[model samples]
Target chain A: AQRVTQPEKLLSVFKGAPVELKCNYSYSGSPELFWYVQYSRQRLQLLLRHISRESIKGFTADLNKGETSFHLKKPFAQEEDSAMYYCALSGSLGGGSNYKLTFGKGTLLTVNP
Target chain B: GAGVSQTPSNKVTEKGKYVELRCDPISGHTALYWYRQSLGQGPEFLIYFQGTGAADDSGLPNDRFFAVRPEGSVSTLKIQRTERGDSAVYLCASSLGRSYNEQFFGPGTRLTVL
Candidate 1:
């Protein structure tokens, strides 16, 4: 079964400091990874995906096949960046089934000003 | 364009009662999904629909949990004999054609069982 693990339950960083949220997955096939963010009173939304290789809101995640990790990183943390982050993995079943995403226990990030 | 929308933003019900949560996907999205989010945890996949057919219902916890997308645009999740454990925010999402497509989420319906 495909599984995602986010080790940290909570992470605190000062404004302007670098931050990293760890994520590891166990999947046999080539997996697509994603990072989702949910701010207070807001819906959970996509932040970045491994396949896109594009940064969003100054956040980036690199997919490491050898380590089976897709860790989200940001060079500078802003106070507004405080939110809950979830790491997710989608199994490749070739069609609409690919939309089924298995998510990890989210990590709460608090950027202190 | 309007994103995915869910009705009854908040619902409070007593145990053993029945409840229905609704979701309206994006106008052209062909795939829709339902997920349940408990406190302090990531959302758990419940079921998914491709057009009007249920492509995956394996994530559903039990037979008491049922869903339908009769018109292929709006979906309803019905739960019977609700228990306190069922109290959580139910989320809905939809994507264009589903092959690794990005999904847009709804605001979610918070269900509380008393």
Candidate 2:
């Protein structure tokens, strides 16, 4: 079985400060990782994926195989960046199910002015 | 053009009653998913549909919980003899396919059982 762990339940930072949301996963086979965000009163949406290797809203995440981690990072945090973030791992075919995602508990980010 | 949509943004029902939550996936999306989210927790997978068939329902809590996607566009989640423990935000999402693509989500339906 695949599992995701997000140790931090909440993170607070000042505007313009660097921010990082840590995520770790345990999977036997090749896994797909993704970060999703849910702003206040908004639906959950994709923030970034390891496969894309692209930054969204100045946020970027690097997949580390040795660490089994995909930590989302932003050099300078903005007020608009405050939201709930969830780290997810996609179970592959070899894991018994490939369609569903195993998600971490989530971390609430607060960017103070 | 639109994202995934769920009906009855809020639902309140009594225990032992039956309830059905609806989900309208994005047009042309072949994969749809249902998840349950409790307060302060990330969403938990309940079921997944690839086209018109249920590819997975392992996450479902019990036999009282069932879902169907006959037409493949819209799906319904049926809960028999709803219990207070079943109250939570039911989220619906859809993706282009059953692969690792990003899944678009709806605002979710907040179900409250009394």
Candidate 3:
């Protein structure tokens, strides 16, 4: 079975400090990893996906197949960056192109000014 | 254009009562998904519909949960004999056509069973 583990349930950092939210996965086949964020009073939105390989809001996550990790990172943290972050994995559904995601518990990040 | 939308933003019902939650996907999206988010946990997949058929229903916990997209655009999830454990935020999402594509999510419907 595919599983995603987020070791840290909560992380706090001051402004201008670097932040890293750890995520580890257990899957045999190639996996598509994604980072989703939910801000206060806002809907859950997609932050970044490994396939895009593009940075969003100065956040980036690299898919590490060897280590089975896709940790989300930012060089500097801002107060506004505080939110709940989730790591999701997508794989083949049945025998078709449709895919379903399995998400980790999530990490609540608090960036203080 | 509007994104995915769910009806009855919040619903509170007594245990043993039945409930129905509705979801209206994006205008042209061909794929719709249902997920349940319990307190302090990530959303768990419930069902997936492509066009008018349920492509996958393996995530559904038991036979008490049933969903239908009769017209291929709107979907409804019906729960029988709701239990306290069934309380959660049910989320709906829709993607263009393929599951790999970006999925737009709705605000979600919060269901509470006492």
Q: How many residue pairs clash in each candidate?
A: 0, 0, 0
| Model 1 deviation from native, Cα RMSD in Å | 1.1
lDDT (Cα, tens digit) per residue for candidate 3, span A11-76: 999999999999999986668899999999888899999999999999999999989999999999
Question: Cα deviation in Å at residue A71, candidate 1?
Answer: 0.3
Clashing pairs in 1: none
User: Which candidate's DockQ is highest?
Assistant: 1
Off by over 4 Å in 3: A93-98
Interface RMS deviation of candidate 2: 1.8
Clashing pairs in 2: none
Q: Which has the better DockQ: candidate 1, or candidate 2? A: 1
Greater lDDT among 2 and 3 belongs to 2
Query: Mind giving the per-residue lDDT tens digits that candidate 3 earns over B7-69?
Result: 999999999999999999999999999999999999999999989999989999999999999
Candidate 1, residues B41-66: lDDT per residue as tens digits?
Answer: 89999999999999989999999999
Which residues of candidate 1, in runs, are more than 4 Å off? A93-96
User: Between which residue pairs do clashes occur in model 3?
Assistant: none
Model 1 alpha-carbon miss at residue A113, Å? 1.0
For model 2, how does the per-residue alpha-carbon lDDT over A1-113 read when each residue is reduced to its tens digit? Answer: 88899999999999999999999999989899999999999999999989899999999999999999999999999999999999999977665445688899999999999
